[model samples]
Structure formats: structure tokens, C-alpha cells
Target chain A: MEIAQSLQQVKSSYIREILAAASDKNVISLAGGLPDEKTFPIDLMKPTLENLANMPEVFQYGSTAGYGPLLSFLNGYFQLPETHTAMITTGSQQGLDLIARAYVNPGDKVVMEAPSYLGAMQVFGLVQANIVTVSQTEFGPNLEELEQCFAEQKPKMFYAVPDFHNPTGVCWALETRQKVAELCIQYNVAFIEDAPYRELRFSGEALPLVSDFCPQNSIVLRSFSKIASPGLRIGVVTGKTSYLEPLIKIKQGADLHSSVPMQALLHGLLQHNNFATHITTICELYKSRYDVMYAELEKQLPASCVLKPVDGGMFVWVEIPECDTFELAKSLLANGVAVVPSPVFYPEGSAVKAALRLNFTNATPEELTVAVTRLADVLNAL
Target chain B: MEIAQSLQQVKSSYIREILAAASDKNVISLAGGLPDEKTFPIDLMKPTLENLANMPEVFQYGSTAGYGPLLSFLNGYFQLPETHTAMITTGSQQGLDLIARAYVNPGDKVVMEAPSYLGAMQVFGLVQANIVTVSQTEFGPNLEELEQCFAEQKPKMFYAVPDFHNPTGVCWALETRQKVAELCIQYNVAFIEDAPYRELRFSGEALPLVSDFCPQNSIVLRSFSKIASPGLRIGVVTGKTSYLEPLIKIKQGADLHSSVPMQALLHGLLQHNNFATHITTICELYKSRYDVMYAELEKQLPASCVLKPVDGGMFVWVEIPECDTFELAKSLLANGVAVVPSPVFYPEGSAVKAALRLNFTNATPEELTVAVTRLADVLNAL
Candidate 1:
């Protein structure tokens, strides 16, 4: 049977393919936006794990919105307004997929910063959205360009990772956040704020979610993958109750709901006294690794290549002289390192920027040092 | 924001809404197709649950296809051929959603027997598939009509619950299975065999899946929801390698993957020595419940309301004298029993038989007895 036309344009995620290759024992993989497995607070989860056996109710069918206890706990945790609500998803990635399917029509304009999260592009692409791109500055999307895109394209939504983005790790400035929220409210374009890396802030004070400024005009996706566990595949989407109800409808078809045991486990962990400290611990651990990689790149990289220091999140973007990035990535892989080429993060056929995204969270300081050396050697030859 | 045109036509699941109503303490809900919570083999899952804290790897992102060990184990567990493969879904509900999203384009014809699974109808409806239905008989789908529909409509797929079918509980005759498979292959139509209840059979000899008759022409969806646990929200879709790959692609965007820890826990539970015994235990237990419900309906239900005894599965369909099923169901709910109106099972605006689907699984025999009395009084009044 022919695959659906919607899926025809969606190439399987390149990062996933590269992540698979990066799994080789000899390779130091910075290709995936993976939280370090060692940082998973299994100790904090032990009580929940042991107690799960006694909670047979979780083993039965659950509500599509989420487990009631988890949903109630999140209301207090997020301090959501009375008018707002939350729905659980298999992951924040699924949260994006649900949003796209819920609101996006074929040929609907969906605005995103160029070099945005690849997974977001894939989800929007699956819905056949006309993905409009805005240029990214050091502080989120270029404000002038975003305003222009909103005015001209009349996009249905603006999707972004406002806090420590996936590929670039560019946290939106507070002014940028407020202005973007204002523009979205003025233009009626929903702001889809994806905050998977929000809590991973180690070196900077956290800013409010852009959605906070335009609560009724935006949806926020929060992920536990970075802080708690990706293996749990649990995510939360919060917005006006009206905005989230449609997503819940689509989610009913998407997966009924995410795993109840996982939700219960996450609820238990989130309530644990040590959970906040656990986040700080992983954040510090990741910051140290990032320091090593950043230092090595500063010390050893060729002058032609530009490097930017990230305050948080897993990756650092390295701008290279215009070259075939896929080939560069392939060569880096051959040298026992894995990094995602920048093109994968952009919409297909968009002007390709020659760059690579290197992750620091999954690898150790020594591995980060060696991986950066391999990366530098490859760049030096170029 | 306007919802996607695709979702505009879709309605929130009627069954889910009624299931919510059924949650009232005074309501004995046969509205939901939920297995008995007691039937969940938490004991079988205990060893795996305790071991989960030690396996930090499960806390990390896993392959989009599935957890490695689970897929490999299912390969052996199902004894799938060398040409076949499996992909895990959040639930069998999601397996259907993926199939619909991956393959069924809008306006594409997909065939199902009338009085089919509501979830299947919801999924196909979400994709905006042109759902063409043929009449169902006591033996299965009317063979002559199925062949006629296939030949004329040239549907993309034939979706069915071949073993202990939903709502109508019409398990196909062996000949019907062979003929459906033959017609699908001959018509170049794919067969989507959703066998969630295949393992729930309490009587009659187990038969080979319709897919077994034409392996290359079919995809089989197997659910652990009924047997293992729905709260885990894990299900498997298996078919030839080529047939299954597109689903994995759609699944990557669906939720990245099912919960890895849940997948690992499911994997470990599947490997437990008592797992097979657990299935037998549930089958026996549900059989007793089914016997009670069937007996009560046979003894007390008016002759005007025709009842079909199911060999297995959670429901028994009662074809009442032509009347408004929705009103009847509502009145029954008011009298402290909750059942699904049959119209929800058919495609929107399709001619709905004046019948109701009554679940026999979740409630105890005593509850079932009282629920049937309530149902009988309502129907007798109607």
C-alpha cells in the first residue's frame, strides 16, 4: 500500500539515524540530545518502583487526559491558573505532534526559527504545514524577522524552544520573550513553547516561559526526559483549558494516554524531597562536561571555525566554513565521534548553514576532550 | 486557532465520555471495554518492577522501533518468520492510529465490518478515511459482501477483530478467515488484523489468525492491555519487514517510542515462567464472568431483545427491537447500569442497528447480575 501523502515528505529523523550509529562502543556520540543516563535518579525512584507492585489500579486502563493524581499534582506544581489545564503525552515530542495534528491544516503556515528542533520540523511536516522560517539571533528568533513573518505569513503558530534550544542552546532573552508573546497575541499566532531543557540551567538564572506572558495565546510543553527520565517517555502540555481540550481529543486517537505507571512513578518522584536537588546535581554535572568541551574547542579549533558557549542544555553549535556538513559528520564518525550536521535541524531545501551541533551531557569530560580533539583534527584538515 | 480540517469532522469518543460517566460510584459500568483489574498479573510483573531501579539504561531514550530486548523477545515469543518484524506502540489503540496515519490517506477507502470496534472507527475517522462497511454475520463478515466490497471499492485495507470480535462478538468461521485472507491478497488490499482479544478466548478451539493465511498481505496488532496491563499502555504491531517500517517511521513522531522502562518491564514480565499461567488464570476468570452475564441475559432478558453469547472478549451485544439505543442506554444509566449505544461503533451517519454493547469483564458476577437486571428492566420498558 502507498504510504499516506502526509508522511511522504517526512524523512525519518536524521539525529535518530546518527544516534544509532553513535551507539557503537568506540564512538563518543554527541549526535543525540540525550540526557546522561548515569544522572537518572534511580535512587529517588526506588520507592515508587517498589510501591508500583502494590498499585494494581495503575495496571488497568487510564483516562486519556492523564492519571488523576498526576494531573492534580501538576496543577499545583506548575501553579497553573484556574482557566488553564494540563494533558499528559508519551513525550513532549508527542505533545508537538498532537498540537500539529490538532490545529495545523495542510498548507497552514507554521513559523519556526531556522535551525529549530528537528523533531518539531518532522511533526509539522507530517501534517503538511508550510513551515515558515525566521533567522535565529543570539537571543531566540530575530525580532524584526519574526514580526515580518507573522504579519505576512499569518502563520497558525510559532514553535520554539525558548529555554536553551536543542541545536543552538540559544535561550530567548527576557525582552525577546515578552515581545514575542506580544507579537503572537497581536497576530493571534499561538506560541508553542517547548521547554525540554528548561531545568537544565546551570550557569544562568532561569527566565519565565514566554507563554507566561501570553498565557491564553500559547501552549507550553514540559518534558521530564532531561530531569527525570526519557525512558519514562512522559511529557506535559499546559495551556488554556480551551486550547488543551482539542489536543486531548487528538491525543485520544494518538495513544489513548501515556503509560499510567510511568505517570504515577513521575508523580511520586516529583513529590520526593530529593528531586529538586537531583536536578541541580545533573545540571552541575552537565555544566562541567560542557566546560571541558568548550575549553577544548576554544583552545584547539581553527580560527575559521566559530564556536559559541552555551549556558545550558546538551549542545554547542560550531559554525564551519561552508562545506558539505554531511561529509564532515561522516568523517567525524569515522574518527570515533558523532555530531549532528546543522542541515538536519532546518526545513528541507532551506538555505543550508554549514555547522554541527555537539552534545556535552552524554559524554564524560575525558570523552568530551577527546571528541573535541577528533572534531578539531577534522576541521583543521578542512 | 481553527482546528485542522481533518480533525474537524472527528468527534470525541462517545465511549470514552460514557466511560467517564460510568466512573460514578453508583454506576455499574459495562460501557468501557476494560479488563478486570484483578485479572492484571502484578505478581508476574513484581520481579521485573523491583529489577527496574537497577537498570538505569531503561531510563534513557530507546530505539523508535522498540526496546531492543522486547522486540527480539517478541520475535521469538510470536515465532514471527525471518521476514517479519514487530514495532511497539503505546497501546493497540495507538497501533491502529499509526496504521491509519501511515497508510490511509484522506478519502482513501478502507473497509470494516459493520458493528466493529469503536476505537478502530475513531482511528480511521481521524485519518478521514472513506470508511466503507459491509454487513457482519454470526460467522463473521458476510463473505459474499466482503468480496463484493473488496472488488468494487478496492479498499486500502480490511480492518477487523477476527478472534472473539468486539461488540458483536462474532468470531469468524475458519472458512471465513481463509476467504477474507484470499480476497485481500487477490484484490491487492492489505489486511489489518487487530487481534487484541485473540488471547482472551475461553471456549472453542483456538484458530490460526486470518493473517496466518496470507502473511505477506497483512499486519497483525496484538495487545498486552487485556492480558498483561493497559496502564503500561504497551502493544505490538507485527508484519513483514517492509510492511512494518512505515509504522515505525510514523511512530517515531507519535511518541518517539513507547516508555522504555515500561517496555523493559513488559519484556521482563513476558519472560517470567508464570506468564503463560497468568494468561490461563485471567481467561478462566473472565470465562466465569462471561458465563454469569450470558446466563443472566439468557434467563431474564425479554425475548424481544436478542442476545448473542460470546466465546470470549469483554462484551455481549444485545439486538433490541428497533428503538433509540442512545435513549435506551441513557435510561439504563439512570437505572444504575452503563452500556454503549451501538451507533458509536459504526461510521458516523451509517445505519446503526438498534442494539447495545454490554461489557462483562470489569464487573464481578454479583455486579454483573444486578447490572443485567437493570438492563433488562430498561429494555423491557422500552
Candidate 2:
């Protein structure tokens, strides 16, 4: 039972550790990025799933490319460029894994935000990429630092979450989006834009997609995990055919294809309801939950412990002055609250000190209020 | 974009190319190993899928390990050793991919049959494993050659298909299965037993599983794709916790988890029906089709062209005495039939000459008769 050298490079995810620790049933978990299950379209899904099981195609093997109807739907929905192609993945996580395999050689340079999606970082690490970090400002990755890494590191891939980034929940400004895309083109790098939370916006106007800015080299990863159903595990990666051919080749050996019944179910849902209406309905439900948690945290937490309000997405980033968030998280877990510390999302030596990410979607208004008060008390004591 | 060095090693799958070429709507493809859709449990699934969709848990994110109920079902079904554990995969293909990542380091030696599953070979290629091939005799891999390779190559893993092997419909003898397990222990190697078609047996006494012989290092992969439904993409990998731990760690970055709705649907099916009765029904259906094709080929083909009789499995391996099967396959496709040539299944230097693999599972008895008649005509002419 010898392990591969690459396995040594991967660490068990901190989120998994936190979630397991949160399973005491007494802990209020703000650790995972799960969308509230109550908001799932159970009423709408009954007929859709019934229709899917009757179709013989749902019981047969699908093309490695994807389930055809969903492929057509995604191609139209994403408004992919004529030269670009779209392939359905098991989820956005598989999309990242495919991209990493397509472009990364062991020790190849890759770039990411200081606090990015932890899952993406794990994929890059498993591939043994030489990861470089760029610091983030409120708007996006710091343009100056990004340019320096692109110039010096010459990374093979630059992974970004331009819209409603995980952990940070910060949407990139329109100018920053364009600049990041341009930097990839100039540096001859693949821009891996993960946009799972793009449709979860509660208030702010949508910015241009990084793919929209540079369609040639930029690859976009989208998921139905948040907006539709995570448990069904449907997602897609879109890019120019030249880059996608390698990803598809690697994907053939990965999982063959995603589950066809899941794809057919999503296709049926799209046919039955307007996609925009579905997004808006879920947004309204999560918006109020976000508001309650933000308002209570603002009232209870000291000014030194800042809770940054997000316009959209699941997480609210908090900065605790002169406190280690990891130690604080352990203490808070003992006090019946759970939050994700910031270190797991960073490249070593570049982690933000005293930062934590709190998820607002899963908790009810009352549960969120109580959880934040407990969190605030722990922060104030520190 | 610069493709990863690993991608250079991956030749595009011959099955994929054959299937793509067969999509012209004229060719009757005996190339892919797709189960007959007519046997799919649509009546049983209709209510089950509907019920699953209404459960909020089916639409939310699942545990990375698996859906709990299904995990419990498999853990019991396999009757795993006390030291062993099991985890769900998107498909058995994913199970193979995870095993490759968990054990293969660059240029590590791995053993496989000369004519093995093409997809597994592709996974080994993606990881750049030093694949050592052992020639197969009528029953299984040549014992003497296998022992020589294990001793000399000192391979990290020995990948075997002890039951209903792909491309070549050969099952290992009881003694051969035990010998493989004993050698792996003797050489400190992992034995990867892929059992996708194990349950599809229409006749012949069951041999003990390789895992039953050596639980310490054997990782067994099982799938519902052949027996239940391919579109659901449910599969499992079982092994001692020592081997499973790395696989679980690697699986986290792969796809997070298998689709919960699909797992629940399968779980519901198992709960609703006698599993043995379901297996018997599908096996009877495919066995009739297999008989039709084998009878037709035996009657029409020349003496030099031999069709091997399989006890039970989807594929029938044919050896063409003096003709190139690749060229024969191309000519047959022109005559409205498609078959997979043996070269794709072999190691670089050891391809079995003038052979082809024909799948009997997907087609009807009528279709299989026509397909073999056309194939026999081409073989006789050659």
C-alpha cells in the first residue's frame, strides 16, 4: 500500500476537518459553502425527474463529451464564441481537475489569489504545480502584484474567481476583470475563471465575464451546484477548442462522463422554467438570510473585528485584528460555533493573518443571529 | 497553449474514434460495451426518481466519501474484511483513475495483461507508469511470464480482470486468481481487480474474488453500469484502509463525490427488488443475443477465422489467421459494420495479430445476427 509521491503533496482539506468537527449537532456551522437545502426546487423537480426516468437515454451510457441536450442548452446559455466548445463535467471540481491535467506539468508555474477557493488549490497541488500567489485588494487581485508574477513566474495557468469568489466573496471590478484577462493573453497563460457563484448575486450589477474580455485563452468553469442542484453534480467548462481538446482527452480517462440522469433532469428543469426566474427566486431566499447575519454581526462585533458585507455569494470575510483565526476557530467550535480560517486558501507564506470566512446561506435568520453573537463574543474576548 | 507532457503519452482512445466514426448512422457498431437499454429498470425507477427529487438531501451537496445509505449498502454487500473500507466513485472508470493517482509515480513499473482494457491502459499512460505486459493464455495471463515480470520488474501494482475481462472475454481460473493475490503479497504490490462485468455471468461457477484471497493490498473495483444502469454512473472501490486513505484523499480533488440522486435511485432499486432476480433477468437477455452472434459467426466464417466461445461476458474475441484486423475493420465499416481491432488493447510491442473484439450486449438478437454475418463475410474474404 505504497502511496504516490504526488499524494504527499496533498493535505486533507481543512473544510472537511471543520465539517467533521461541526457534526456534533450542537455546533452552528458556518464552515462549508453549501447552499441552503430548503431553497432547493423540490416542487419543480418532482415532474422533471419523473419525465427523465421514462426516457431510455437516461439509463444508457452518455458520450464522453456530455449528455447532448444539456450540451446544447449550455452552449446556448453560455453564449460561447463560435470557435469555443463546451463540455459538461461531473462538477466544477472535475472541471478544475481536468484543466490542471491538460496544462500543468509537475513543477509548472501556476498563479492564484492569496485567498482563493481551497478546492482549486488542492487540485493544483495534487498536480504538483509550482504555485505563486498574488495579493487581493477589495476590487480583485492586485494588478501590480499580478503583473509581477506573470512577468517573473510565467505561469502556465492563472486561476481566478472573478464573480463571487469563495472564501472572500468579492466580485472583481469590470476593469480588473479585463486587466486580468489581458495579462493572461500577454503572458501566454491560460486564465482559469471559476464562476460557480456568478448567478447568486443579491444586489450588485453583473460585471463582464473574464471570458468575455479574452475569449481566446480564457477558459470558464460554471456549475449548477449552487444555482440548481449540487447533489446532482452537473457543471461545464468552456474554452476555445484548441485548449479544450486536451482537457477532453484527459477527461476521457478521468470519469468517461457525468451521470446522464442528472443532466437530463437539469435539462427538463430548464425546459419547464425560465432560467432567469429560477435564479431570481433562489437569490431572494438567500438574500434575507445574508442580511440578518450581517446586521447582527455589525451590531455585536467590535470595530477592530471587521465583518465585510458581500453584495452576493455565500461567504462574508471577517478580519480579526491581532488574533489567529485558526486558533479562534477551534475556540469557537468549543463555544458551539464553526467558521473556516483563512490559511487553507493561501499559498504558504502569503496567508492573510487573523482572517475567517463565515457562510450565511445554510443557517436560518434566528440561528444565524445566535451564531454571530457567539462568534462576536469570542472575537471580543480575544 | 502548451499541453502537459503527460498528454503526449495518451493516444486518443480507439473505442472513442470507432464510436465517433460509427455515428454516421449507417454502421452497426459492435465496438462499444454498452448494456442494452431495453433491460433498464424504467418501471422500478419511475417512482424512485420521483421520490428522490422531492428529498432535499438529494439536491444538496453530499459527503465526499459517498451517500451514507449507499455506502452502508455496499459495505454490507461486499462483506468486506474488518481491515477494509469502501468508497463510491462516479464510475468504475473514475475508480481506475483514482487508483492510478494513489499508487503510480512517474515511471513506476505496473503490470497488466497484454490484451487489457484500453481505458485502464490510458489511465496508466496519463501517469507515465512503466507498464509491463504479461501475455494471456486461454485461461488467464501466462503464469510463468507473470511471475517473471513480477520478480524482475518489481511492479508497484498488478492490474487484473479476473472475471469477464474487457476486449478479451477471458476469465481467470480459480488457481490463477489465488496465484495473482499470493504474488502481489510476495512482491509487495497492489492488486487492482476490476470487476465491472463479474455479475453479468450467464453461466459458469463463480471463482473467489482476488480481494478475498489477499485483503491487505488488493483494491477491488465494482460497477452497476453493466448490471443496473450505465447512465447513473455508480461504482465502488474497496480495499484495506491503508490503500483506501490515499484514494479518498485523491478523490476529494477529483469530483468531491458521486451524484446523490443517482445513488439514491440505485439504493431505492436495491431496496425494492431482489438483486439476484434482476441480475438473472438481464443475463438471460444478453446471453440469447450472444448465442445468436456466436452461432452465426461459426456457421459463416472460414476455418482460419476463429471465434472464441465465452462462458459469459459481453465480448467475443476473434482471431483472424493471416489478415490485418485493423484493415479488415475499416473494410467492414464500409460494409455497414464496426468492430474494435486488438492492437489498441495490447502493449506497444506485444499486440495479438489479426484479432478483433465484438460486443454482443448492446445489440438485439436480430442486429447481432446481421452484424456477425457481415463480419464473417469480411473475415472469409480476407
Candidate 3:
């Protein structure tokens, strides 16, 4: 049978390709965006599981919005303005999918960062949205380019990871965040800010959220996958209720609701003070790992291959001069080290780039050292 | 903030309207299709939750396809044909949505039962599929009507619930089922068989599945929502590997994967011999409730209202001559009972109907008796 034209347009992610090659037992995979398992709050989760087992109500259907208690907890935690309503999602990915469905019309223009998250791009593609990309510059995403895109095409939505961006560990400057929010409101375009790594800061002060700058036009996607657990698939979409109401309705068609027991488990974790304490512990661990990976890269790699300054995110972006990262990635996989090529992050699949994204959170210091050494050897041979 | 044309085409399910009214303390709902919370396997679930507390791996990201052990268990249990591949879904609802994304294109023709599951209709609408309905006749969905539909329009797909269908509680005649399968294969149109209610039968011989007839083109959707716990949201999509491969990739973009802990919990529940015993207990309880409901309708409802014969399944579909079920549903809510009107299930929102779909599984026999009596009184007053 024939596949839908929309689905036919979606390109497979390079991360999956790299991971498939990393399946050999000896390969250390830094390609996929997975949270460290050891950081899971097992002790905090125990009481929640025990309580849920006895309360048979937890095994029944929940409202399409989410479990009431968890929703209430988030309402309090976020100190959400009256303008914004929040609903639990299966994950940030589902949040992106629902936003695509509720807002994106076929052939509608969507503005995204040049090297945006591939997962988000795939979802927008499946809805057949015409995506336009703006490059990330030293100050932030190119504002002149964004202004031109919005002014010329009046895109329906703008998707960004303003803080701790995936593939590239750069946070948008605060002024840039404020300007983007203002532009969205002026152009009558929705702004989507995905912050899976916002809470995982190892250095630097926290920046104001895009939603904070413009409550009515901005929507935020929050996930517990990094700070707490990924397997639970706990996340939320927060925005002005006017914007959020449509998504909640579409979410009903997506999966009815997220797992109720999982929501209750999230509630239990948040009820105690340990939730914040646990996040701090994870940040500390990731910081040390980041330091080790950075040290190794500086010692082994030539200065021509620039390694961007890392502050808070899980990944370190490296620009390798005169090389195709995709071809280089295959050789690195053969050498038992997995890394993601930069082209997957760009909207245009064949856009030229020689950058590699290496994750520092899922691997230990010893493993990072060995992986970097092997990567350097591969580059020298090339 | 203009909504997408695709989303604008979607209509909300009537169950939501009834549920909102049923929130009053005095109201008893026969509206939502929820399993009896009392019948959930709390005892069987306790040890699984306890075991999951220590297995920190449950809190980490899993493969996009599903948990391995659960996949293997289902593969063995289903004894799927060599041509078929299966993957776990967030719920049967997600399964429906993914199938729509994989197969339906904007303006593409889809054929469905006249009074099908509204949740499904909503998903197809979200994708802007041009849906046409064939009425369900006494023996099954009128096969003659379906064949004519296939012949005239060459619909891109046909969605059917052959056994113990929702709302109508009608099973297709053996010949009808075989003919539908043959037609789909002959026309090279995909056949989507939804079997959420298949395992909930209290009486009737098990019939052959559509997948058994046309393994290459038929995609079967299975759910554990009724047989086990809906809160876990475990379901599966089974089809030929060629067809399923694209869906698995799309599933990655949908939510990465279903909750890993929930899959682990489901795996634990299936390991014990009690899984079958527990299902039997649930069937018996629902059977008792169905009997009470069937009896109440016989005693109280006027001859003008016909309650379709229900051998098994949770609902009793009623057709009331000369009364609009939608308008009556409002008056019934005021009189302290809740039910879904039939128009929401039709492809066209304003299609005329005098039908109501009442769920008998969520309430006890005593509650059903009282609820049915109230329903009858409301109908008499109308």
C-alpha cells in the first residue's frame, strides 16, 4: 500500500542510524539523547508505587488533561500566571506532535532554528508544514533572518530550544529571547520553547523563559526525563489557556491521556523536597563528566577543529574542518565510539556541515576519555 | 490565532459532554467506556510495582519499538504469522492515531461504520480524511453497502470492528467478515480491524480474525484496557512487517516509546497463570451487570424503544423512535443519568439519529438497575 505523502516527507534521524551501528557490545553510544539511569530517584519512587498498587483507582482511566493532583502540583510549582494552563503530556515529543496537529495547516510556513532538534522537525514534516530555518549566531539565533522570514511569510509558528539547545550547547541570550517573544506576538505567530535540559545547568545563572516574556503567545514544553526519569515519559505543555485548550482537545485524539500511574508517581516525587535535591545531584555528576570530556578533547584534538565552550547542556558541539561528519561518524562507530552528525539537526537534509555532537551525560569519565581518544585517532587517519 | 483546517474538521466526542454533566454528586454515568475499577487486578499488580521500585532501569529510556520481554511474550502469545510484526502502543487510541498518520492523507477517502467509535472519528478528522459511513445492518455492517462504497470511490482504507463492536454490541456474520477481507485484498486497500472489545466477550464462540484471512493487508489493533488495567495504557498494533516498519518509525516521533515501567508491570501481570483466571473473573462480573441491564430495559422501556441484542461487550445500543437522542440526553442529565447520543459517532456531525449508547461495565448491577430505571422514566416523560 501507498504511504501518506506527509509521512513520506519525514526523514529518519541520524541518531538512530548511529545507535544501530553502536549495537555491538563494545561500542559506547553517545548518539542517542538518553538520561543517566543511575540518577533515578528509586527511593522516592518506592512509596508512590506501593501506594498506587493498593489504590485500584490508579489503574482506571484518567481525564484526557491529566491526573488532578499532578496538575495541581504543577500549577503551584510553576506559579503559572492566570493566562497559562498546563496539562501533562506523554513526553515533550508528544507535546510537539500535538502542537503540530492543532496549529500547523498543510503548506503553512513554520520558522525554526537552522540546527533544531531533529525529532521536532520530523513531526512538523509529518504534518507537511513548510519549514524555514534561521541560523544560530554568537549572540543567538539570527534575528535579521528571523525578521525577514516572519515579515515575508508570516509563519504560523516558531520552534526553539532557547536554553541548553540540543546538538549545540548554546543558550539564547536573554535579549534574544525577549525579542523573539515580541516578534511572535507582533506577527500573530505562536512561539514554542522546548526546555528538556533547562534544569540540568552545570554553570551559569538561569535565563528567563520565552513564555515568561510573552505569556499569551508563548508555549513551553517541560520534561522530567532529564532531571528525574525518561522511562516514565512525564512532561507537560504550558501556555495561555486559549492556546492550550485546542491542544488538550487534540491530545484526547492522540492517546486519551498519559499513563495515570506514572502521573501519580510524578506527583509523589514532587510532593517531597527530594525532587529538587535529586536534580542538584544529577547536575553535579554531569558537570564532572562534562569537564572530563572537555579536557580530553583539548588534549588530543588540533586547534583547527573548534570545540564550542560548554556551559550547561549534556552535549558538546565540535566543528571539524574539511570533513563530512556523517562519513566521519561511521568511522567513529567502527572504532567503538558513537556520535551524532550535525546535518540531522538541520531542516534541509543535505545541508553541508562538518560538526559532531558528543553527549557527555550518559557516559562516565573513563569512557569519555577513551571515546575522545578514539575520535581523535579517526580524525588523524582521515 | 487561526486553528488548522484539519483540526477545525474534528468534533468533540459526546462522551465528554455527558461526563461533564455526570460530575454532579447525584449523577450516575453510563457514558464513558471505562472498565470496572473494582475488577482491576490490585493483588496481582502489587508485587510488580514493588519489583519495579528497585529496577532503576525502568526509569530510563527504552527502545522506540517497546520493551523486549513484553514484545517476546506477546509474539509468542499471539502466534503471529511470519509476515506480521508487532509493537506496543501507548493505548489503542494512540494505535488509531498512528494508523491515521501512516495511511490517511488529506482529502483521501476512508470508509467507516455509520456509528463507529467517536474517538476514532476524531483522529481521522484531525488528519482531514474524507470519511464516508456505511450503516450497520442486522447481520453486520451492510457488506453490500461496503462493497458498493469500495467499488465507487475506491476508499484508501476500511476501518471495522468485527467482533463485539463498541456502542452497537454487534458482531459481524462470518460470511460478512470473510467478504470484507476478500474485498480489501482484491482492491489493494488496507483493512484496519480494531479488536478492543474482542477479549471481553462473556458468551459466543471465538471467530477467526481478519488478520487470519489477509495477513498482508490487515492491521489489527489490540488493547489490554478491558482485560487488565486501562491506567497502564498497554496496547499493540500487529500487521505485515512491511507495513509496520513505517509505523514504528512514526511511533518514535509520536512519544519515543510508551512508559517502560508500565510495560514492565504488564509483563509481570502476564507472567503468572492468574492472567487467564483474572480475565475470567472480569468477564463474569460484566456478564452479571449486563444481565441486570438487559432485564431492566425489558421491564421499564416502552415498546417504541428497541434495545439491540447484546451477547457480550460493555454497551447496549438503543434506538428510540421519534425522539432525538441528543436532545433527550440533556433532559436525562437533568433527571440524574448520563448517556452518549449517536450523532457524534456519525461521519457528518448533524446526521439525524434517535439512538443512544449506554455502557454497562463501569457500574455495578445494582447501580445499573437504578440507572436504567431512571433512563426509562426520562424517556417516558420525553
TM-score of chain A of each: 0.99, 0.97, 0.97
lDDT-wise, the better of 1 and 3 is: 1
Angstrom error at residue B278, model 1? 1.6
Q: What TM-score is obtained for chain B in each of the predicted models?
A: 0.98, 0.97, 0.97
Over B1-382, each residue of candidate 1 has an lDDT whose tens digit, in order, gives 7788888888888888798889899999998888888888898889899999989989998888899889999999999999999999999889899999999988999999898887788788888999999999999999899888988888999999988888888899999999999999999999999998998989999999999999999999999989999999999999999988899998888788889989998998899999999999899999999899999999999998888877888789989898888888889889999999988888876788888888888999999999999988877776
Best by lDDT: 1
Candidate with the larger DockQ of 1 and 3:
1
Off by over 4 Å in 3: A349-351, B349-351
TM-score to true structure, per model: 0.99, 0.98, 0.98
For every model in order, what is the number of clashing pairs?
1, 0, 0
- Give each candidate's interface RMSD in Å: 0.8, 1.0, 1.0
Which CAPRI tier for candidate 3?
Answer: high
Scored against the true structure, residue B102 in model 1 reaches a CA lDDT of 93
TM-score of 1: 0.99
DockQ of each: 0.89, 0.86, 0.83
Candidate 3: residue B232 Cα off by (Å):
1.4
Q: Is candidate 1 or candidate 3 better by TM-score?
A: 1
